[model samples]
Target: MAEYKPGEMDISVQEKTFDGFISMVTKGAILCILVLIFMALVNA
Candidate 1:
């Protein structure tokens, strides 16, 4: 196993807030696509 020195202990972890942000963006894009399709169907 590799070890990091005390000052060089660069750390990385999946932040909980990041999950919420990604979910919000994904949901927004899906919602926008659905709305556009609905409009096209109605206009046609």
Candidate 2:
């Protein structure tokens, strides 16, 4: 078995996936807020 080395693993893909997740969450939150505002204005 090979010994493990700290900080030697490649994580570019993980970083990209996490960034995309954060971006999607941010956009979804903004859309939800906008929808809520519209609904409130329309008394729904």
Candidate 3:
């Protein structure tokens, strides 16, 4: 059986996926904010 070791496993893929997720969420939030501002300006 393999021994368990903390902080010894590769997490490059997980880090990349998380970074992409964060970037997507940030962009989506910015787009929503901009749309809200536009709607408010137009009195919609």
Candidate 2 per-residue lDDT over residues 4-43, each given as its tens digit: 9999999999999999999999999999999999999999
The candidate, 1 or 3, that scores higher on lDDT is 3
Count: clashes, candidate 2: 0
Mind giving the per-residue lDDT tens digits that candidate 3 earns over 11-38? 9999999999999999999999999999
Off by over 4 Å in 3: none
Candidate 2 error regions (>4 Å): none
Sort the candidates on TM-score, descending order.
2, 3, 1
Clashing pairs in 2: none
* CA lDDT scores, all candidates in order: 0.84, 0.99, 0.98
Count: clashes, candidate 1: 0
Q: Worst ten-residue run, lDDT, model 2?
A: 35-44
List the lowest-lDDT window of 10 residues for candidate 1.
7-16
On a 0 to 1 TM-score scale, where does candidate 3 land against the true structure? 0.89
Judging by TM-score against the true structure, name the best candidate.
Answer: 2
